[model samples]
Target: MAKETEIEEKNLLTRNEFDMLADTYQIKPPQFFWQANTYFDTPALEIKEQGAALRVRTKSNNYELTLKQPASAGLLETNQTLTEVEAKRLMEQAELPEGEVKESLHPFIGDTSMLQKLGTLETYRAQTSHETGILFLDHSVYLDTEDFELEIEGSSEEEVRKWLTSILTDHDIPARPTPNKIKRFFTRKQELAR
Candidate 1:
């Protein structure tokens, strides 16, 4: 009975299924796309400044920074979900000076660019509980202008690393690649147990 209850309580949603539901109901995308995965981990970080002129370095290490503008009035708490217009309103309510707005286009999902790049684009792919097919993202971008991370949906993390390596290496940028946190869970847990 306990095992059955656990299974029932642990129902998972897949990426495509979730996306379809979002489209059908006109629900805004969840703030943390990575939540769809069993575990979320980012192995590499890229640091770039606004204006595309310079990359920020922390003692020779490049770290990515993201800045987000909320559309609603007042500060949007972490884990808060907001529509695009609401996010914009939040930004204005914060009384921050106006900044540049950019556009991003997704190759697979119609020729539309709902993707926004404020600074550095941190890209990735991962499996979701909703569908068998993987979310194929050409790239997921993170903006340094905002204080948030861009959780890109990809078919897998390996695919994401390949894409990131290609783009950064092409641009003469070096990155520090790390493994997913899930893979290290056992190790970390065992260490703690000791």
Candidate 2:
């Protein structure tokens, strides 16, 4: 884990310093976005209720890949358009491959009908594209309110791996390409087993 002080120092970099570092590192400026999701989140009664989603995000003329899933009810309250009551009702009726029921903290029950506006979610995307001999790779980065995503695509898996490794070194960001489980459907069975 980065030490608190280290994070603070990184966050404190002046805009000019950040821009300079980004330029030197071939990193692009951070981009921000607000996405409105309209999905029926699963109820918490099942242990394996967390599901998966696919996102194709773009900014500054660059495109990237994203994978996401529903988290806690609190997370839904902040991201979705449904009121607590509406969400609870939808969750309770949500059909899962493995059937289950929805659940929430006690406080959510009494405040079902009321709606509260959540803040606009912010995200960033970074990318690099290059070719090696006859093969080409397009790499992209994604960040939601909570996590970061890196995706690699090329003529072959090996080329994708090489492309990813090169980006890691250039940006000084430490990460490895997870086993490619990319899928088109956004469902509990299709997503990673998180």
Candidate 3:
């Protein structure tokens, strides 16, 4: 299940900061699109406990099953294409369609059947490439939470991070502590349940 592993760095921003970056870079509206990500885990959140995540993301009628695990370089991602039916079973019944993604999850969460759909997060994302890395500005909504984030993924984490820092600093924007989208969604879900 070793595949598509890479480092992704994220920074949270205020509404003003997001708009400022957009204006500063002259980012066009044509680069924006929407995506919905549905996350899954055991009733006790075994995946997160193991420092891993599982999700089925749907974009333009295509469904993909992805498993993310913590790795030395960054996060190791194993991805597999899922048919509409397979995606349905995975989301509705906590079933894996039998493939690399399933095999990858077995080591982390022994019983895949325990998985349950956490919730779906919808994001309107704008992206463009720079000399250092790919830049993403995301506005996401899930449950009762809405947030904006800046993410950069490039050939190397250090280079991309330094580049991101310089831009934020030049604009006098304080980088806020940021959590991955899954964490934010799970946090809000837990809060509302309590």
Candidate 4:
């Protein structure tokens, strides 16, 4: 398990604002690529209640299983690299791999077999480096809902937050409450279920 802290700040963006920010960052349109993320939880939503999220993400045919948990500093992320075969099995059969990520889930989910696919969200994303850290532009679609977001990821929360705020101020873009993608996805999933 490769464990690390994830610190980022986010803001909701309009399509026009997204384009304007790309210009501000001097990024071209061709920089974006697709990323697919499949989320998992017990049928009873045990993982959600525990304030954790489990997901398999694909980038350039490489699969990574990651478990994100609440931490004192930010989110504690534990990642496990998976081979193509392992990723295929998990996606097709809901068979979670036996490794660090699964082991870490034991406290919240006793029987690993309880894990099930919650849903998938796909994003067309691009990023550019910044002195503060990195700036990510995302247009994600899932459960028939689409949204745009700007994320500032850095080694420290305070830095990311300050940079994000400055970007908003400089661009005259109003800040919108931005929750993490998982929460947004799960909230929409629940809405569709009703």
Candidate 5:
């Protein structure tokens, strides 16, 4: 398992804006890939209520489980690489993985066996390097809803924020309040359930 703090900024974009930016930056084929993220939480949504999120992502033939919690810089992320067997067990059975990820989660979810699959979000992502940071272009779909977004992750939060602002201003794209994918998914799930 690996642990680190994530520092990133995000902005919602229209499909037209996404395409225009891609063309302008010459972001082509090889830079894009698809990923599927499956989220999990307790029946009472204890994880989210505690301001934490758990997810297992699949890309190509690889799977990884991640736990994200509020942190000083951005979010503290604990990741664990998983085998197909392990991933299937967690996704299908709500079985928590062993090791650091489990240890880190115990404080919040005493008995992880209570965790259950919440929902899934799939995204086609394209990435490029910029002076301010690594820019990620994502087109995501979840619960029959779709969205386009841009994210910049860098060492300096101030620089990334400034750079993102400049880009939005230059392109005439209004920065809307874009909730993170997990939040959006959870909200949609609640909506559909009702």
Candidate 6:
């Protein structure tokens, strides 16, 4: 298990802008990979109400469970590596894996058994380092919907914001409001259910 404070700046990007930036940076080939993220929440969304999200991400034949909660800087992320069987059980049966993730989540969600898989989002992502920060380009698909976005992660919020402003301006990419992947997944799921 690992605990870390994540600080990042993100923006919504148009497909054209995403392609333009990628080309300019020469971001191609094996830098990009696919990952599937499965989100979990209570039937009443109690966990979301408390400003927290739980997800299991599968990438490169590895699985990891993560809990994200609001923090002063950005978000507090707690992650735990899971075996294939553990990941399957959690995603298919809503069984909380035993470890730090579950222990930390129990306080926010009283009964772990009530947690169920809400939805899944698949994304193709590429990342590179830029000026003391990491830049991420993402294209995500969920519930027949798709979006392109960019994210910059840094040690400090201010640093990330500064770099993000410059990078977007240089690339001529308009800055737009963007939610995290989980929020977008939930929104799309709701839309599809209607």
Per-residue lDDT value at 23 in model 6: 88
- lDDT against the true structure, per candidate, is 0.26, 0.32, 0.86, 0.92, 0.91, 0.92
Q: Over the stretch 1-194, how does candidate 5's per-residue lDDT look in tens digits?
A: 89998888899999999998998789986888999999999999999999999999999989999999999888999999999999999989989878788999988888888999988899999998899589999999999799999898988789889989988999999988888999989988888899
Q: Sort by lDDT, best first: what order?
A: 4, 6, 5, 3, 2, 1
lDDT of 3: 0.86
Candidate 5 Cα lDDT to native:
0.91
Q: Which ten residues in a row have the lowest lDDT in candidate 5?
A: 23-32
Task: Name the runs in model 3 displaced over 4 angstroms.
Answer: none
Model 4 per-residue lDDT tens digits across residues 163-182: 99999999999999888999
Q: Is candidate 2 or candidate 5 better by lDDT?
A: 5
lDDT string for model 3 (107-188, tens) is: 8878887888888999889988888678889989898788988888887778877888987889897877888999888888
Query: What TM-score does prediction 5 earn?
Result: 0.97
Whole-model lDDT, model 4: 0.92
- What are the TM-scores, per candidate, against the unseen true structure? 0.21, 0.31, 0.94, 0.97, 0.97, 0.97
Better of 3 and 5 by TM-score: 5
At residue 73, give the lDDT of candidate 5.
82
Candidate 4 lowest-lDDT run of ten: 21-30
As a TM-score, model 1 comes out at 0.21
How high a TM-score does candidate 6 get? 0.97
lDDT assessment of candidate 2: 0.32
